[model samples]
Target: MVNKVTVESLTYEQLAKVFDHAILKPEQTTQDVITGCELAKKYDAKSVCVKPCDVKQASDLLSGSRVLVGTVISFPHGNSPTAAKIAEALQTVADGAIELDVVLNIGHLKSGRVQACQDEIKAVIDACHAKNPDVVFKIIFENAYLTKEEIVQACQLSVAAGAHFVKTSTGFASSGATLDDIALMRANVPDHIEVKASGGIKTLDQVVDLLNQGATRCGSSGTDKILDEFKQRRGL
Candidate 1:
């Protein structure tokens, strides 16, 4: 079992590394993306997960910052055809996104089409790596639609397909990441395969709780508030 990380014991840098700083709402304007990048730069977050269309602009704005640019593939829904997802992955990377949070084909997984799911993931991985071998790929399970056994299988497939992380949600799901689901993902994947918990994670305590449960990263739109709360609570 992974050892828990207490919030009070964490450094500011460690706390910063845990956030992806989501900016992916459908109605987010260009100004919103710019403001989001500014927040990411100010916090020195791990990345700013934006919509595919914002990849280029976000990358340009965050050019000299430590914050990497991330975009989604198949997005809130995982129903995009394999070829289309592959194409989207390629274009996003070319547009300058170095990290990708891909939604798994939930329909396929729920239908017990495990191989198909794995193949699709592999294809996207191949496409991303073809452009930048160092690109990070995090597979989104959207756990609200999955059973415990299905979650295990999805984790297995993600690892087998050479994904860098297994994410818990898209933030557009019926529910977001839970401590139980985070634990399940951590237990199933190897240490090298990181876990990213997203969706409904707004407060500092929630992020810390998920991290203690073995989440390596989190997706949240409230990066500034969360960090401020962390500092306030810690007297930093």
Candidate 2:
């Protein structure tokens, strides 16, 4: 878990580390991935959240840098079969990804199949750990498709399944992370399990606001803009 400090007290590097610069758009190409990794290194962001196919390339590019490589599983939708998700997770870890952002099985969760959802999440995390126990796992809730009660359910299920973090959105959904949802997620989970606010988080103030509200991480594609604004604010 990150240190519990006010956002105002965070220095420029501390603020930059709160962001997981997203490179997961489907239309993005290899060049985009390269550019994204460069941006992550430039700002010393936490990680570059890339698509599954770009995991190896991203890992290679980010190797020896403070920015780690993170990839998504089952992507915007969490409807993939359990076997496939596990396979994808293992492969990404093997390709040198140290962090993973996996989408929860939203359909199963909403259909009241809590046990199945938990089982799948645990199974995926287990497989990844079997390969490398240090690989971090963040469960993406894609909150746009879920109700408040369901979101809480997702948070509980993620914790029960041993997820390291519970995330807000995939950014491909109709809506993205909201302050209300971030606070709600933070309130629902124990302190050990962190909350990540993603999707449409584009400004430094929004990042600061989310951090203040208990989000340990925020995902965005506009990392350069946010970090540049931070430098301007601090006159770095």
Candidate 3:
């Protein structure tokens, strides 16, 4: 495939745009969220993905900066009730988060409850859109848990439900984002929607490889170290 390690494909400019550092945890304090947002600003990252408890702090810190505030809903597990997921998304947004990553109900999708899965996504999307048209909604399908056909189906459902992006994993599942998954997601999704590759993206090469596979956004805590490595290699 494409060699994305250089400044050519995933350029310094583009590299900065791909980051969405995940700072989701109970032990993480407001200061941690603020520092994460600051780091995003310093590195030119797109956003800092925080948990619900820290969304407000992240939003406040990132307000005047280009770094956006993102929060996860129904989190690492897609087994939560649809109502719970909806409430999480709504409350997180009301808490000042501009971006949301909601886990799709894998049970529904895999059990051939196609309409149920679609409806859940649509309801959440509708709720977010109604709250504020500018709010971004990304649906996480946890690709590692799915077969190839299931992955394609998930992408189609995400697009049909009006999600802004189809994300790979929550980093707490059987697997995280993979090149094969990204390729499948990119090829299956419509051009209007973007692909997000997350989970276990620790090195610079992983980021480059994912981007080359059509991942427009990346979620990881390794952003700073990875970028540092890139800059050092470039003698910048």
Candidate 4:
């Protein structure tokens, strides 16, 4: 388990390491992606989560930096056919994305087709691992559309599928990550699997609160503002 540290005591680097700076909006332009990568590099963020099409460019821009390039598979909807999602995962890895945040098939899970959902996730994980064994895979739950019990089941499936993390939302959902959800995910998953709180996280306090609740990473577009607030509070 990660040692708990007060928000005020965290250094800028420590705070930055938990962020996966997001650039996944549909309206985001190439320049926006470039700017986002710059911000990720500047902040030394853990990764820059970009749209699938932008993976190659993002990887090039982030070359020589510690920031990893990530992209979404099956994206916000998560309703894509399993074969399609697996193909997308392979293509993204070939495009230089070292991390993938894949949306779970919400429809299948909601319908109690747990085996199908787990199989789909496992397929993508296997494909990615075959190409690059170190590729990080985060399974997005889109918690706004799931019940507490469903969330627990999703976490279990994620671990069974060999996913590296269980994420909260897609940021397009009606709601995003909550402390309660993060805590629930933490309790359910094994120590090898981490929790990532994404969406609706705009403030430093919100990020810190999620971390306190056992979120190891976060996906946010407001990376600049949040880090600035951290710097201000810490007198950096």
* C-alpha TM-score for every candidate: 0.98, 0.96, 0.94, 0.98
State candidate 1's TM-score: 0.98
Which lDDT tens digits does candidate 3 get at residues 1-236?
33545544445767887888889766788788778888889998888899987887788888888888899988877788878878888888898888899899887888988788888989987987888888898889888778898889889988998899999999887779999999999999888899999888899878878878888899998889988888877677
Q: What number of backbone clashes does candidate 2 have, counting pairs of residues 3 or more apart or in separate chains?
A: 0
* Clashing residue pairs in candidate 4 (N, C-alpha, C atoms within 3 angstroms): none
Winner by lDDT between candidate 2 and candidate 1: 1
Model 4 CA deviation exceeding 4 Å by range: 1-4
For 43-152, candidate 2 gives per-residue lDDT tens digits of 89999999989999999998899998999999889999999999999999999888999999999998999989999999999999988999999999999999999999
Prediction 3 global C-alpha lDDT: 0.85
Better of 3 and 4 by lDDT: 4
Candidate 4 lDDT tens digits, 48-118: 99999999999999999999999999999899999999999999999999989999999999999998999
Quantify all predictions' global Cα lDDT against the true fold. 0.93, 0.91, 0.85, 0.93
- The whole-model C-alpha lDDT of candidate 4 against the native structure comes to 0.93
Distance from true location, Cα of 16 in model 1, Å: 0.5
